[model samples]
Target chain A: MQMTWREIVTAVHGMLFGGFFLMACFGVLVLLHRSLAAHGGSEVKEHGRRRERIFLILMVLLGWAAVLSGAYVVYPWYRAAVPPGVTNLEMYPQRLLMSDPHTAGWHTLGMEWKEHVAWMAPMLMTMVAWVMMKYEDGSEEHRRLRAMVGGFALAAFLAGGVAAEFGAWINKKAPVTGGRVITLSQDGK
Target chain B: MSSPREAVANGAAGAAVLAASLGCFALGVLAVAGDGWKAVAGLLTFYRPTGPLSGVSTVAILVWLATWFTGNRLWRGKTVALGKVSVAAFVLLALGLLLTFPPFEDLLLGK
Candidate 1:
């Protein structure tokens, strides 16, 4: 089996970074909900607090990694221009999708929306992480802070979901292909 | 009694949330601007390969950092009214989210 370099990068961006970011979003949601009891107060211990900070920091890092890889690494390949007389647009995802009317919406709606929306995830998550780091108590004041940041976390999750969904659908419609190929395994003759 | 350092304050959290929302809103506004205006699009092309996206994201991030630093500096250790801050932040965030939507953007630009 063989896979192109771009394919691997895209896979890493999607399956690894994007996938883990989504899971982390969900985990933070649950963690925050439990941390701030509805009646008021938190049950998180000191160790748990440290662990939470680590996770949130990691989540923020993952969010940035996902968007940066997608925009800088994979997106350049996706939006690469097609040379004249090159009828095969296989290497150009944006052009490929736009070539057909039926698939045009994939680029216009899917990619346009995904590229911009994905960014909200990291910005909001950064805020959520910093705020979580600050409010380290179980008082009513801290609980309200947790609840507000929890809402921000929920928004971050939705943005990530939208981006991942569109990224998957767009790639399926016109995948980014080309670049040096690597053989996964050699055949025994 | 809890010491000053030990007191629970909403200033930092408020600052962060507000700054993040402003950054997001800046991104949404720039996205729409870049899409609607050719001059804006060309101006925002910091990286030729990445088009306006690189500039858009970079500027928004800078705006976020600036606002966060300023807000933190001014609001740190002060217990500002969080309810008002939360309302403004969420509203800005909602508008930002709306502006980034393709259909909504089109509606604004008459595209």
Candidate 2:
């Protein structure tokens, strides 16, 4: 089977995006390790290590999400281009695609949003964790505020990503003309 | 028994390595953009992945590995500076990745 330009473009985009996201995830893991080492000592007396672990886990999970989304964006194009009978048809319908340019653009935007949030979430949590360590004598209100901010940021980032992915999926599945061709020629030329 | 001062120096060195890695990653991104699949294929598998951003990811992985090594060394030494630098590098790496996304790239290039 021949590869369409669209499929080729999408595949290239997906691979680059996926590779970057994977790097980001790896970076997050590095950061998580550093944060835990640096500030794991200062968490609340009863919940210190647990809190740090939770944040670390969250960072790691965010990395996985980015990687997964990146894969979703690219794998469809690969499958589409694969020769029939060489690959399973069951996989093709399950592949992700944005039916229109607008949807594709939005989904691309969504991936960016997800990546930014995933990056920020760990940094923010690391800051909060550091602060908790420094202000061991600080009030509960301050700690609560830090947690609230970090949690909110994470939620917002995740929501934006989910929305983008959903939008892309819906757009791809939207009913539309499957095949139509148009050509223009100068009169009597 | 490495002194605290020595640890700090080592941490700084590690941070520098990570910074360099990030720069390389950025360069790879740009190369992918300018040259497309050929650039990516050169960086990733030998099979020659096609398109502008094709194998640009392979270069990214290398950079990430370098950063991880530096950060890991610094963490082992318990240097707060190294930890901070690692976090900063990670943030930059993430930002760079986001910037390479098609939407952002289009906006930058007015595509």
Candidate 3:
């Protein structure tokens, strides 16, 4: 019935990646729609239209992938713990509590996943923006688009990397151990 | 009436600005890869530990400023499309940082 911290961490990792993937997919969709409207025209070249369509499809697929992966990561825990009679919404509070800071494994997992989502979402969004700008028709608009997307992407990449590193440092300095099963404090002192 | 020499000088100035902006953009990319300071500051408002986050933020801000200045110079007096895009990008970056940091955390949390 009990799960190891490693297993929990792995699940959190999956969730984080999944969340980012989903966020990216959404960003891409937004970019695609905007690009299609802004750049599409009667004079649209065949190449431009083709590229636009490809981006649109790609964003949709990535979004779905993130949703599926995210569900896969968290759903198992939900299914195993929740009783058949109880609905997910009904069991949500307990599940959330179980995942709180006091429970080391759950806490670590939650924190890790949150960090992952934070990093991934912005990074992916930046990438989507970059790609949209890249494929834009070589107009004044295109140049502006590139600068906007590139600037944001650059910012996100910098910010996310720093946050992740900081989180890692904290984890190392104050390692969390679940329950009272193991304690290293007594030996050192 | 502007002479041919003046036109050439103006063209050269524009070229120099573009080149400088491009360089800054490249530097920003490198900083992001290496976990630069601005990146750190942007993310520190979240659950990040204090030390490294501050360091990275310091560096990232410097780089961002350098890039912005270069970009502005390159765009000259005109509101070129590229200039607008660059402004938008900077705004988004600031927004993202805000969302991740303290005051904006509530917004990100759907609170």
Candidate 4:
């Protein structure tokens, strides 16, 4: 069976979101473990470091997937269908791309963030992971680096969630129909 | 026993792993952002369509290989400190991520 362009976009977008959501959640868990370790003593902290390392690896791989998938969807697939003289910014206006008109202010703000900030989670987390790898488990410096990376992961999670919502919204709002220019509301309402 | 010079050379190779890893990650960001010159230069994929992703992935894979090769020799069992340079580099990278985001752009430009 032949899948429609919309289906393809949707599937890829889903992968991007799923990967990011899992990574972000994992980042949070790592952070929580680290915080508890600060007070939980040496043995507990050692366990936290090991877990954090695994989570960091996972986050980096997920990040790679998210970035690559996002690029594939936007650059080659969606843009190919975009008409001449139309930029993504123009096709999907920032107001709509950033936020939903039907949503409350905070929800809109939250959505807006994904377009701008969500990509940073993996980059920052990877740096933290690399830094942590150099130091042995349960070291003071390792904990500090873990906390920092965890904080970035949380930031990424919020942005990634927003991005996933936007992807879903766009899939419905503007699908690629054959030989026709699709026009969607600037606000996606 | 290895000479002191050989030991220093190995340490440098090990350090290169961190640099390569960070470089690959940064290249990935450049791919997403499509920052003109860097994106084009980094485009290893050669296919015009999927250039950004291709370039980013190519660079990332190459860097990871280098890191893996050097992993066994890095730090010589001593503690690794990121030091001021590494810290500053990370901060700059984080700021780049934030600044390039649409919301951050709007926030900064009074949009």
Best by TM-score: 1
The 10-residue segment with the lowest total lDDT in model 3 chain A: A175-184
DockQ (CA atoms), all models: 0.64, 0.05, 0.04, 0.17
**Cα error of candidate 3 at position A141, Å:** 4.2
Runs of candidate 3 exceeding 4 Å displacement: A1-56, A68-135, A153-189, B1-111
lDDT of 2 by residue, A1-189 (tens): 343444444434333443333344344344434444444454445476556456545544544454444334443333244355554333243223334565444345543334332333233333333333333333443333233233323432343344335434433553111222323344544
Put down candidate 4 lDDT per residue, A1-189, tens digits, no spaces. 344555555465556544554555565656546553765364445676687678667767776566556656553544353456654433433333344555333223443344334444444445445645544345454455445444445545554565666656654554432223344445555
TM-scores of the models, in the order given: 0.95, 0.43, 0.32, 0.53
Question: By the TM-score metric, which is better: model 2 or model 4?
Answer: 4
Q: How far is A11's C-alpha from truth in model 3 (Å)?
A: 9.9
Q: Tell me the chain A TM-score of model 4.
A: 0.57
Q: Which scores greater on DockQ, model 1 or model 3?
A: 1
* Prediction 4 global C-alpha lDDT: 0.49
In CAPRI terms, where does candidate 3 land? Answer: incorrect
Find the candidate with the highest DockQ and give its number: 1
Summarize candidate 2's per-residue lDDT along B8-93 as a digit string, tens digits: 22343344334433643453355435534444445444223232232344344455556656655664434444344545555654
Q: How large a fraction of the reference contact set does each model reproduce? A: 0.82, 0.06, 0.04, 0.24
TM-score of chain B of each: 0.92, 0.49, 0.35, 0.42
Highest lDDT: which candidate?
A: 1
List the candidate 1 regions with Cα displacement exceeding 4 Å: A38-42, A187-189, B1-7
TM-score of chain B of 4: 0.42
